[model samples]
Target: MKYIIGLAGIVLVFLLAFVASSDRKRIRYRPLIVMIVLQAILAFVLLNTGVGSFLIGGFASTFEHLLSYAAEGVNFVFGGLANVNEAPFFLNVLLPIVFISALIGILQYIKVLPFIIKYIGLVLSKVNGMGKLESFNAVASAILGQSEVFISVKKQLGAMPRHRLYTLCASAMSTVSMSIVGAYMELIKPEYVVTALVLNLFGGFIIASIINPYEVDPKEDILEIQEEEKQSFFEMLGEYIMDGFKVATTVAAMLIGFVALIAMINGIFSGIFGISFQDLLGYIFAPFAFLMGIPWGDAVQAGSIMATKMVSNEFVAMTTLTNATGLSARAIGIVSVFLVSFANFSSIGIIAGAVKGLHSKQGNEVARFGLKLLYGATLVSVLSATIAGLFM
Candidate 1:
């Protein structure tokens, strides 16, 4: 009954969104419909199959142990606060963001990440018709943020076609920042992180390809990334650590400011509704969370996180999701995937601001493509959840 409602609602939402779309000619339902069907199959396996149920048990346990390993990292970094009974908010939460940024830098220096990029680029090239460098940067951005990943491909950005440039921005918006990956790994599941990486990589390729489908040239992108031109392994790793520090600081600052702003806005809404802002968030997004396979008992609480994520940032949502009580592990998995991207309203301004700042010449062009990117990211995240939900 629940999944029935979810499927119906998803169909309705898609149809309604489609109707509202002024450019009906460009709507290609192929990927969208395929994703929907996949979501249904996923829901069925989770709900009905004993095999699926057992598999979830394995994944859930493995996820628990993986989190424990991550917790060790947290504990090592912040000793006394490591007590499981009372996790330190700053050490466990903020510091992990700092740590993962450093780790990404470390991985990149070791050339471990480059190999991953090569394989990822190959897959994207074959699957989505993207060039090797474009796909490499997209995959790298999964491990690096917008500015940092740009470093990996800084030279290429200036010369890339307008369509590819937009794709880069869109992919950045659609994926998680590497700095927070460790925290999210502990919050959700290792399998979940791995799955998101896979989906983000796939989504970057597929969605970008859909937005800019020109097979006109088979040549590699004119822009070449030059991360290895001057630095040796140790030097590069140090640079990555420094880069991570810069990124972590920037993100921490953004989160602090953004969180305060959200509280202020929610407070304004709170006065109108005569309920606390959190309560209002819980009231509204609960139904959608319910459709995404969150247990009814935890739906409202989990919905609050989802709503916060949609309105503000996924980091806050993940923080709320990790901290929220009275939720089943399966439900957590579902919500984690649902909250796994830059889908909220805040991202609109972020993209608009960033794109406009850099591409002032095509600022209007950037604005024109903004909503499509948003819609595409939303579809990708939700569709990834549905695929992952089946595994749950």
Candidate 2:
């Protein structure tokens, strides 16, 4: 029964993408079919197999050690604020991003990341039937982040067409940055985070192919990465450390503001309508949750978290998911996978601004299709969660 519903959910996602497709005739079914099969196989391997357990365990253990090392820095700077037993969110969960970000910088500095990103992207381009630049952006976006990823391809930004630009932004919004993956592991099970990361990579392409289909002209398929200005090792390390701190502080501010605002709105709604705002959103999103194979009884709560992610951000939604009660393990796993992407209203502006900073005209093009980009990316998340449901 669950398998039937999961299959139906995939069909529903394709139908939604079809409705929004700019050129319905250009939608490629072959790659979409192949990718969907791959998603199922990967999800099964990652969620149900011994090998998957070993890999996820190893990945989780590595992050656990990294977070502990990061805690050493945090304790040195802000040692006495909290009690010994209590773990503060900002210190324990968010600040570790700084350490992870610096590690990413070291990898980038030594060119290890670029080498892996380029060759992996080349392999992906062959499978996805997209241009090398598009495949590279998707992989780079996962590692470097949405805004920073554009800097790597700044040379191609100005020359990119609307169709290609849409694909680029869609990939950025569908995957989370590697720098924050540790932060995410702190909030949810590591296996779900790892599964979502891999599934969303393929899911982004699947939805983009359907909604923004275009054949890359072989002659125009050039990929020129923008090289960063050379800096001494220490100089580069300091910059990434600062960048990581900024991201941590920025996320802290967003949580402070968004969590309070949502509380206020929930209070107002409860006062007037005898129900909370998120509960109302849950009611609206419940059907989609149901489609993802969450039990009908728990779908409303799961849907609310899914809607929270779309409206606010993944961090807020993950926090909510952690606090939520009465949800079955299956529903929790499905929603955890669903909340792993940057498919929120705010990301449209973030991606647009990132591009606009590089190429004004191209950034404007991104803003024009901002909502469509979010739509496709959200579908990508839904598709990933749905495929994951088949195995769970």
Candidate 3:
């Protein structure tokens, strides 16, 4: 029965995209069907089978080890402040991103990450029936982040058409950066994060191909990275360390502000309406949650988390999920997968600003289509969660 609902959710998602499609007639059903079928299969393999159990166990343990290693840096700086007795989420969970970012930088400096993203992206492009750049952005965005991936393709930003540009930005918005994957693992099951990452990679393309259909000229489907002047090995490491710290501080600041503000807003709404703002939103989003295979009884609570992810960010939503009670395992699984993307309201500014910093006119165009990007990316998240729901 849950699988049936999940299947219906998938169809509804594509129909929603198709109805709002910029060029409905040009929507490629072949790639869309292939991607959805692939997502379903991948979700099953990752969640229900023995191979998935072994893979997820290794992934969780590996991330756990990395989190332990990251704790070393946290211990060195704050010492007893981050001691296990009373370590806060910011210090223990979020700050580890600094270490992860440093590791990513090391991987990038050695050219290991770029080579992998390029070729993996090349293969994905062939399967997804999109341009090489669009496919590369999806994988790169998963690793490098939404904003930073643009720098990797900065050379081509100016020349790419609007439709292709939308595809790139959509992929970025739909996927989460690896820097925070540990933090997510701390809050939710690692399998959901891992599965969501893979599903959203394809889900982003499926929705984008429908909503923003266009043909990439084979002659212009470039996969070249923009080269930068070489810095000494130590210089690069130091730079990455600083960059990691910046990312950590940025997330910490956002969490403090957003979480506190949400608390205050919920207070006001509760005072006046006899219900919290999130509860009201939950009621509003409950139907969508139900369609995603959440039991009707749990739909309101699940929808609240979903709405929270869109309004604030996934971190805040995941925090809520971690502390939540009365939800079934299936509801938790679907909600956890849903909160894995960077598809919130604030990302509009972040993505557009990132592009604007590189190219002004194109950034303005992205800004104009900002809401559409959010709509499409949010659908990508829903699609992934729905598919994961079937197997869970």
TM-score of each: 0.74, 0.99, 0.98
Q: Which candidate has the highest lDDT of all?
A: 2
Q: For residues 123-157, write the lDDT of model 1, one tens digit per residue.
A: 65554555666667677667666544555665555
Worst 10 residues of 2 by lDDT: 28-37
Q: Of 2 and 3, which scores higher on lDDT?
A: 2
lDDT of each: 0.64, 0.95, 0.91
Write the residue-wise lDDT of candidate 3 on 60-119 in tens digits. 998899989999888898887644678588888888988888898889999999999999
What ranking of all candidate models by TM-score puts the best one first?
A: 2, 3, 1
- Candidate 3: stretches off by over 4 Å: 82-84
Residue 27 of model 1 has an lDDT of 49
On a 0 to 100 scale, what is the lDDT of residue 168 in model 2? 94
**1-392 per-residue lDDT for model 2 (tens digits):** 99999988989999999999999999888887788888988999999999999999999999999999998999999999898899899999999999999999999999999999999999999889899999999999999998899999999888788999999999999999999999999999999999999999999999999999999999999999999999999999999999999999999998998899999999999999999999999999999999989999999999999999998999999999999989999999999999999999989999999999999999999999999999999999999999998899
Best by TM-score: 2
